[model samples]
Target: MADFAWSLGSPSLRLGVTGLSRAGKTVFITALIHNLTHGGRLPMFEPWRAGRLLGADIRPQLHPDVPTFDYRGHVRKLTDARVWPDSTRQISELRLTIAYESATFLGRSLGRGKLDLDIVDYPGEWLLDLPLLSKDYRAFSSETLERGREPRRTAIAADWLAHTSGVDPLGPADDEAAGRLHELFAAYLGAARGGSLALSMVPPGRFLMPGDLAGSPALTFAPLDLPESGEAPRDSLWALMESRFEAYKDVVVRPFFRTHFARLDRQVVLVDVLAALNGGREALVDLEMALGEILGCFRPGRSSWLGQVLTRRIDRILFAATKADHLHHASHDRLELILRRLTDRAIARASFSGAEVDVKALAAVRATREATVRRNGESLPCILGVPQEGELLDDHLYDGKEEIALFPGDLPDNPQALFRPPEAGEPGFDALRFLRFRPPPLEVTAEGVSLSLPHIRLDRALDFLIGDRLA
Candidate 1:
């Protein structure tokens, strides 16, 4: 079993980086490591600014079983190729050792201090599955089915719901029947995740992003409409799914919690709030619900026998609204406010005693620069960047070669404005034009050494997460 307790020797801190698909988890990790190792300008980071930080370098990852994060390859992809690195599909780890001088006189007299910072990268999809631990198969089925009937999901779920209508829960279990249902259900989940819908809370996370369990019996089970107040018949479809669900919890979810999540000392949840806003009210609400469920898994005061035996509680959590570069600097604080309001209920529900929770709007790899454009004799704040190939605006498709200044619409002054659905003829979040931008070109020094990736508020985020420890 992985050791949950930290050894007293050189201090080690495990920082978890997780977010849903396209939320920039991979880029965030890459930028964080690159900044520290390459001595990127992090004026807000106290240790670095105070001249206490000596040096930072990559070290051998502690976990042999988990794959090392491909930092070098990802760096090449971003700096050399000028394209974003691939999104995270599985759990990976990277170790960075920072040597620093202690601020305290007594500590400085003792000697230099070295801290091992272990960065754990994993899919946010898997975090959604943590709620499964508290729910039975029947509850899972009923809840999933109810959500599928929601207005935002109903259309995408039509084919799956239609297929489920013909499925008999009490009918004898058949491989063919189960396989067909699983396929349809997985398809619905995929559709819900695509485009402007960007729906969250799609559970049985493996259905959408099955890493290795693809085609396994554990993954083949889909939620079915079960009759109320009756036990599942032996050898029936319900029984088969229930068994597989339980097996999945035991074989997949439990191991992850015990081995990785429970050991983390700090965590960063990257959120693409712009995407959620672009997706409209339904998507925003869905993201809130999903975030709440994920936070519930980290409920504080875990003093149970198993909790005591398994892992320590995370002390710091940072929920970051990523891709802040998409908006003008003026809207960054507004974006942070929106995220804070979005997750307010979730933070309260978790009630993490002795833990500090914070939210910020940040871009780990800044893809745009601020500019002011005059339109109709009025100056407007804008962002200038190279839009990715095929990006569309005003019926014009970008060829990816020209630099353009876009006046992405402003965020509401009141965060609550995002919660309510728009009224008839009212302009909704659709007014905001968020285009995917390619990674910025890297700057090289006179000696040919490449500077670190540019970012917005990454230093403040790092300070909040690990500055105290470095001190």
Candidate 2:
């Protein structure tokens, strides 16, 4: 056992998890906790493979005021009900005490290695709010409006764009006017997020997740058409929107940042790249833009002893392409390549900050198995799993009970090919099929011990994110 005096003084690394809605934040956390505590197969995680990792156990909440993550409840749903856990609706916390053996003789002389891992889960939709701190209302409005004018967004942003184009920023401020304009803008944001469009650049994030501030005036402001060089008249429409916008930054975003986000030592941004691909190239571009902006907000760098005393900076950031089990094993590398290329720019910026950055394709929990099927005269690689009911693919709608094999199309080996437009009749990404899969039943050993959740490259994710700390 480690001595409490010295061991307790060791700093705990808080890992923040966030991404777009349905990007699997909740599921990822659930799997992380489940795997660590249960001794899941993790050959790539050095501490585990070296036989230095002992075990992990849930600990008391570090912040008692925050709601605790429902790890047990989520496990029951995945193991018993055979379904995916729900997405993150609000900020939640989980703390783990990781016990291990020291790799170094000096560390062994002191005591065994142990660490407190504080995990923070929050809605990714609201993540873009962090950047609002540096942006003035005019800059925000300009950027937002410019994006709305893009070819793909033009139709979805029609009503709000038309209304804002006519708004007189110098007009007298009226509560009713503000409410109406904001309603239209919020509708456009809703439409942008709805169904298959799946655009990720939707900001004024509070508009999407307004918890208690749903109808408050602070949330009732929308971007307006204003001149670039002059200020609007005092107490004008622009003034109202600007004040509320600032209030959003000060009253809402800042507290969350100071309390939770700024304190993180590591972060994992889960991306449902497959969903974005299914939405089309426009969605992919928007996803890239959103990810880049979100990454820009992270104060990433090496966390030295002095730096730790002065301020906290995320020293490591992992960008994971989730739902890897949807494709055959042969296509895993291609998917990872596509993700790295997709976020290549963001990865470059983060890396320049002196932080270790990497991208991996993972499924947290594997819900499918690979198989080879003979079609006509050739052998085709496919994945077998139970599709969610009513899911239509290749003209067959699944009934949610029967297992089926799907031939996921191949991805370009050349990552650059994704950035370029395809020929008129050419199809690669657009031809692939990605289907939703139910959680697979756990396999039991002869002694009745159920195996830990199966996954694709999740061990690599663990190795990259926190393996060094364990060492």
Candidate 3:
């Protein structure tokens, strides 16, 4: 049965990744695939040398029904900016075919098989709807209302909270009061989404696209609200609230999961814990709650017993805190702490539920270096980083401070906390101050290119997802 199950007709791995908008999925996938194709330098795995013909040739997927991604094109655009244009909107899917040769147990070579890897990219907006799967109006409204109190979101919350106060929490959900709240919620999302108005996943383009919607509506929403006024009980309001919550789950939540979530081989969940830390206690609480709820979708805790017994587990889950390039090298530890705290709830869920999870605080791209400058008798940490687009100050003169050697702990949510700059500069303040990510130089030798740690990380992640079949 095990051999039969591992046959070519069966999928060796099914990894799923979920992250908020601007979380760096495209780059991670692109780099992982790029390194896989050129695995000479990678640890433990033999590269696909030209003459050796390891038997695995990455071809465009031959699935007649599913769409194939231009993996090479995206890679070129990411590596060579002069080629394909940058991606601006959410692409439907990026699928690739990875075929390779692995040693067989019988001391004889096994037939070459294909690995169909699919990565579906969608908006983060839809992710916010998952909690609704198990929530009612009062629960949803109150939560959204409470979340509105954050300093960054106070401006938007003022309008919806005021309107919610007039409605009877117990009144029918579709009552005039309920209707007003619904519209306000939608409007708030629209404003948060640059008036996309549709309650789907807000894509990364909204944040990094450079078009409109940069500092948009903040995508703020209240969880269910309790009756603020001591009015008579109105049960209809509860009914209305429940119905809308259901509508949100069915219309928005289910489709994304069915289409995108269910098709992966490995998964990564990105959290912006630094922003939450900067936002303070309320933001932290909200971040924790959001992380918990989002992780619930992938855990076996909610799976049916049959699913737990039969379906493949989401073997490797990488909870990465993105935008690591924002901070200097010294404070990477504190960033890890902040991230661990923020994700403790989800980590607990995965741990108790039997899923293998790795929490990493990475910048996906190393943006800046910790350099030093000596002023007077004291030395301070300064950033010697270049920007992604803009030109950096061109000066080779050193002020004694060289980039500090920082071995980042696991990736963190609050990258800023882990930042220990050699010297303070006004420019490198937040996530916005990141240097463009450059791939580590390929180590070449007499044989071919060699593998590095990043390449190993990808290999292990892949192995966990489907090593048995690949081997």
Candidate 4:
């Protein structure tokens, strides 16, 4: 009862937006802001559709310590330059103040409603480190080493593993050795993330996207081969590495959780499911495991100890498969189904008491339009757009200026087929003929008024994330 009063008196919500690299996090944020500020069409967002939403504008962020989200700069890049904004490399915050009319009779009698929507944007790579909070140095080392030895990862992990075999855990600490190990390990992680591997379990995320802590000792350490049950010798390499790992969790991971994550009221996890699908069964399963681990960090139920300490919980979590524009509308539902299946275990493990969970296929900035192409007397559903230059399809290279129609293949009717390993002489899963597309040119009126960014179901996402608050 007291909490309800507090919420009503001070209407504020912190929304956390996160996703792996190339998952459209930056574009999503920019499009969302542009649509709301410009009074764009949002039929699915009840607050906007019902005419209760009066206005929404950017205000100064509440936290002075954190850098402001570069809304203007990103808008310029997207609107003026017609190019996508760069991916988020660090933490940033933005506050959107919304004015609305009250829905209830009593509230309407009182006056207009207002809400401070604080949006926190951060790298999803950072969330990968949360599982490290409970893991000791030896446990982390053993798990990472085991993963490195997996068949799919062996090729990429060879250089790092070769170096690991030569280093003695109990030998004297050497800065050069540590640096070399860190570099090799970081390179392996980068390789796994690139192309079709799409591995998501890489930790000490600073190593991969080290913003300001590039060369710091806390980020220099890598997992080493150590005995199953033993203590590290005093001042030995193992001991030094262990200490730095703890420091990273203490100084880097914990602060992020305490300051930013703990305060979030809602969250949107963007995913590039198409990329994983293209990678094959291994990448899909790895992505699922990674998402499960990340979801476990959320304090879902009020009975949890972390929930008690934080005094707030993430009451709603929306797992969205981004870049839906790459596929035809006919496959959108299947895409959503795949995402739901991918997150099923994580959603169950979270067991968020009184929390709502949903999955959707959305394109923050739709880059394609629906079309039909005729081939062999059959009309095939296709998406027409300008593929980025050098994007190859069927031995043809796109020049970036030519509009082409692409028939992105269909997803399986039963998403369960995605989990099975491929049989001999068979492609693992139904691979989409996906290609990156340049942002669509904006529409403008004769009077020089530009329209809001076009999107696929973005308003529905807005409704799921914040519609209840406005009411």
Query: Which candidate achieves the best TM-score against the true structure?
Result: 1
Report, for every candidate in turn, its global Cα lDDT versus the true structure.
Answer: 0.88, 0.83, 0.49, 0.86
Residue-level lDDT tens digits of model 4 in 113-216: 99988888988888888778779999999999999999999899999999999999989888888889988998998999886688777777777777677889
At residue 415, give the lDDT of candidate 1: 85
**Each prediction's TM-score against the native?**
0.95, 0.91, 0.63, 0.94
Q: Which runs of model 1 end up more than 4 angstroms from their true locations?
A: 1-8, 300-310, 421-427, 446-448
- Backbone clashes under 3 angstroms, per model: 0, 0, 62, 0
Which candidate do you rate higher for lDDT, 3 or 4? 4
Indicate the residue-level lDDT of 218 in model 2: 78
Error of 2 at 333 (Å): 1.1
How many angstroms is residue 66 displaced in model 1 relative to the true structure, after the best TM-score fit? 0.9
Candidate 3 residue 163 Cα shift, in angstroms, is 4.8
- Worst ten in a row by lDDT for model 4: 1-10
lDDT of 3 at 149: 60
Model 2 ranges off by over 4 Å: 1-10, 165-172, 227-230, 299-310, 349-353, 424-426
Model 1 lDDT per residue over 1-471, tens place: 444344347889999998888889999999999999888999999999999989899988877778899999999999988988988888899989999999999999989999999999988889898778779999999998898898867889999999999899999988889899999999999999877689887888878878777898888889989998888899998999899899988888878877888888899999999999988888899899988876766673456323654457778889999999999999999999999998899988777776799999999999999999999999999999999999998899998889999999889878897898666865678788999998999888999988889999999999999999987
TM-score of decoy 1:
0.95
Shift of residue 188 alpha carbon in model 4, Å? 0.6
Candidate 1 has which clashing residue pairs, if any? none
* Residue 471 displacement in candidate 3 (angstroms): 2.6
